[model samples]
Target: MTASTAFGQAAATGTAPAFDAARALALAQETFDIEAAAVLGLKARTGAAFARAVEAMLAVTGRVVVMGMGKSGHIGRKVAATLASTGTAAMFVHPAEASHGDLGMIKPADLVLAISNGGESDEITAILPVLKRLGAPLVAMTGNAQSTLARHADIVLDSGVAKEACPLNLAPTASTTAQLALGDALAVALLDARGFRTEDFARSHPGGALGRKLLTHLRDVMRAGGAVPRVGADTPFTELMREMSAKGLGASAVVDGEGRVLGIFTDGDLRRLVEKGRDLRGLTAREVMHPNPRGVIRDDVLAVEAAELMEKHRINSVLVIDDQGRLCGAVSSNDLMRAKVI
Candidate 1:
């Protein structure tokens, strides 16, 4: 058979020759190249309209209502999530669902972001008149500048891609990648405009490790009251060892009569004493303990900061004190590891 005849047969049958490893790798590389080039082109498209879209979203007192169809809808969902997590109020509304009854989700104060590659999605364009009547500003992301959605939009963001990574140009590939990138850009720009900080992100993601690092305070994870291993400065060395062993904190705080922290003694100190063959019979806490040991205020610092302080001082534990310099609790590196702040 002729090469053209074989190609026609394959296309008609919706099948192609089996791909070997080298061909598969080459195709994957080509796909990445197409998508990367498409993303690079977006840098020049970020102009006045992009800035206007950000301003419009920021100006709205209500949430951003994102609408799209099919693959664009999937990207819109992610965009909405990113915006909401980054301190912007946003939610995705399916165009078909909006036509049914979800249009109620859009308020007069809300801003609408509609995505359609061709700028002619019937489901999305059909609602433009309604959005206009509701006094909601419309921002359209599309490749076609003169399409219906673009023409009716208050702000037009050109997300045009030169080609699709799909060999047949039938599937949404590079176009969707461009849309996703533009959505991320919008979310990040709004994040910067609002001066969103890491703590703000942590607040939004309290279940994650970063949130634990930022929001967990020393008081929350410290051993307090009776659980803290502490002894008076005049306590005998045998009593101090018993307290340290019972508490299992690997260290004991040596404080004065009023419970003000004076120093600390750890297993390392015991090792040094043993190596010197010092007599424990007459030793006191004041003689064996480290003077003016490092400590942190119980409620004044985060657990992560306490961990950093431990690392800085090369110590395994720290005494927690109150504002008036009274010893209140103690925290160890184990506590930080358990809290997932280490």
Candidate 2:
């Protein structure tokens, strides 16, 4: 058959010849190259406007109010969420909504972050007077410095790009990416200026697992009083089994004469000891203990860090220690997962 006939037959049958992997890869690479070039073009052009925009946001005693339309609105929501979760109190308000009585949400002490790539969004530009009358500082993110929004804004963050990655070059692909990244850059810059800390982030995200791990205290979760499964060093193997079953922590802390932690004897240790076939009835905790178990402090240790220590040592639990190395509490792999730290 002729090559053209074979090609036509394959196309008609919907079972074309082997795909061109090299051509497909080249197309993917070209997209990233063009977009990267666009991002690279955003260099020192980020000048005093960037710094003033951040200062205006920092001076906001109430909240950072984000306004945008269309794709810029979607990107603004993400930026608002990131800023709120980090340190800066912020929220996204659609410009369309602002024009419709939702303008009451904006306070005089608030700072307005307006996003419009073209700097001529009718919906966004239309609301400038409303926000201006409210006495809030306006920070505009725009591609056109000469546009009305940029010219009227108290400060303008230039988000212009050299070209779009779209094949037709009419879509808002590269410009939107640059705008999103620039918005994040602004949020994080303010976060640093505000001296935001991990503890502050935890407070904002308390419902999340990371927040629980970082904020919950060790004393709150550790098994204490009668709940702790403990065995004295002189206890016999028969008594130790009862302790293990009673406590249900998979192991027992072996304490010494002063009720201080000496070592640990776990289920696996019991199995190993039993295999030796010595005298189970007479075996003491001290005799069976595997010495030098890893321990942590009680005061300020993060639950996630405790989980890391457990995984690193390939152990199920660790003894919580104090400045004097006394056992103040205990933690297990179960505690870590329950705290959502692991």
Report, for every candidate in turn, its global Cα lDDT versus the true structure: 0.90, 0.81
Q: Score residue 89 of candidate 2 by CA lDDT.
A: 86
Q: State in Å the error of residue 72, model 1.
A: 0.9
- For residue 324, give model 2's deviation from the true position in Å: 7.1
Best-performing candidate as measured by TM-score:
1
Question: Measured by TM-score, how close is model 2 to the native structure?
Answer: 0.86
Q: lDDT score of model 2? A: 0.81
Query: Cα lDDT for residue 58, model 1?
Result: 94
**lDDT of model 1, residue 280:** 84
Error in Å for residue 56 of model 2: 1.7
User: Which one is best on lDDT?
Assistant: 1
- lDDT (10s digit) by residue, model 2, range 1-342: 533344456667888479767645664666688777666666657878888888888888999888888888998999999989878889999998888988899999999888888999998888888888899999988889999899889998889887776545667878888888888888789889989998998898888877887787766667676777778888987898899899888888888766578888898898887798877777788888877777544535666777777878888887776666666677788876776666
Q: Which stretches of model 2 miss by more than 4 angstroms? A: 1-27, 274-277, 296-300, 321-329
